[model samples]
Target chain A: MQVLYFAWVRERIGVPREEVETSAATVADLVEELSAREERYAVAFADRAALRVAVDQTLTDFDASLDGAREVAFFPPMTGG
Target chain B: MRIVVQDAPFDLGEEAGRFAQADAGVGAVVTFTGIVRNTAAGDLKAMEIEHYPGMTEAALTEIAERAQTRWSLSDVLVIHRHGHLTPGEMIMMVATAAPHRADAFAAAEYLMDYLKSRAPFWKREITADGAAWVDAKDEDEAALDRW
Candidate 1:
């Protein structure tokens, strides 16, 4: 699967985007997997309450299913104008 | 529906005229323009905005659709600028038109709220001391919950 980060989320994770091979089937599972990789990932996913997730291209809840999902994005609540 | 996401400053009058000309069924037009603020109180000198090429547009289009469904809007226009922007510059514009003010106003606000909390754009500010990434505001998320 492909994982993407934007805005300050990208800064916290140290990368803009990446591809991940994971056994995770849900958005929460993917977060746990990435959070285990390093302190940066941990910090990025530190507070799920401050984060927003999108499955494929639609805004979704963290518990949303990701079965066969091609792309998953993690970012803080958007503040665009 | 007309959505223009660009990096240049736009004339509100011209844009409004264009959308008005697109259809005559529109009786009320509600437009919202976001501008760069000179004083942010936080660490900010100048700001730079970045967005995901295809994804940003797709998400914005979907948001416009949602607004359309919720209102009797005859036409919609959304224009968002990218790259570095200074104070007083236009960052974005969202306009909605309907037969009544209620529908036009609701649609415009809905699109703005969704764009504030859901769009995939990032803004970074450079202050007198240093540069820092802008964090999403809790207020933005809360605004969406009202709808």
Candidate 2:
């Protein structure tokens, strides 16, 4: 699967996207796995309140099922207009 | 319905003109343009907007579709720009055409409200000191409760 970071999360994570091999069943499990990999990931995922997640291309909650999902994105709440 | 997500600046007048000429029965057209504003400190240089390429178009189309379903809209147009933009530059615009003024105005407002928070774009304000990501206001999210 491809995990993507955007905006401040991208800066904190130090990469825009990365391929990860995981058997996680949900977005939260994936985040937990990543957070254990490095300090940057932990810092980026520290405050869940400041972050938003998207499974595939659709905005969803952290508990959203990742069944057959190929892409996951994490970013701050959108500031578009 | 037309949803455009691009990095290049768009011509508001031309887009509005084209949207207003939707159909003979269309009696009202409403357009809202969002501009990049400088920081309150007034030292901002530019605004950098980043967006999920594939998701932006999809999300915007969904919002436009919802607006159309909620209101009696004859036509809808949404154009949002990403990448670097100077203060005061147009960032995006939404135009709605309907058989009556009330529906046109309401639908246009609905599009703006949803586009502000639902879209994938994120804005970073560049100042002389440094750059900072703009936080999504709580009011922006709460605004959706009206619908």
Candidate 3:
């Protein structure tokens, strides 16, 4: 599966996107997997309270199932004009 | 529904006129323009905006769709600017047209709220001392939860 980062999360992660192989079934599970990757990933996925997740471009909860999702994105709560 | 995510400034009057007159049945048109400010936290001087190419438009469209679903809007126009922006310049516009004032107002507010909490744009501010990225605000998200 592909994971995307946007806004300051990208700046922190040092990459706009990444491909990860995970057996995670839900968005929360995916975050747990990514948080274990490295220090940067850990920092990005740390404090899930401050983050927002989208499965396949639709805003969703962390408990939402990612059964057939091709893409998952994580970023801070948006602040666009 | 016209959605334009561009890097140029737009005329509010012209855009509002076009959106309102597009359909004779549109009795109300509500438009909101967000502007770049010269000061932030009382010291910022200038600001620059960055966005993900494909993702920015996609997120904005999703916000527009949400507004449409919640309101009896006849049409929606969303125009957001990117690249370098100056203080007092327009950052974005959300215009909603409907047969009644309620629909237009609701849709316009919904569009702004969703954009504030969902759009994929980042702001970088340059102060007298240095430059830094702006963090997302919790209050912005809390504002969306009211609706």
For residues A1-81, write the lDDT of model 1, one tens digit per residue.
889998778889888889999989789988998889888999989999888888887889888988989989888766688
Off by over 4 Å in 2: none
Alpha-carbon shift of residue B88 in model 1 (angstroms): 0.8
Candidate achieving higher TM-score, 1 or 3? 1
Instruction: Report, to 2 decimal places, the DockQ of model 2.
Output: 0.94
> Could you tell me every candidate's TM-score relative to the true structure?
0.90, 0.98, 0.86
Specify the poorest-scoring 10-residue window by lDDT in model 2 chain A. Answer: A30-39
Error of 2 at B33 (Å): 0.5
Q: Candidate 3, clashing residue pairs?
A: none
- The alpha-carbon lDDT assigned to residue A43 of candidate 1 equals 91
Q: Order of all candidates by DockQ, from best down to worst?
A: 2, 1, 3
Worst 10 residues of 3 chain A by lDDT: A72-81
CA lDDT of every candidate: 0.84, 0.93, 0.83
Report the lDDT tens digits of candidate 2 across residue range A1-81.
Answer: 999999999999999999999999999999999899899999999999999999999999999999999999999999999
DockQ in order = 0.68, 0.94, 0.59
Q: Write the per-residue lDDT of candidate 2 for residues B47-104, one digit (tens) a residue.
A: 9999999999999999999988889989999999999999999999999999999999
Worst 10 residues of 1 chain B by lDDT: B38-47
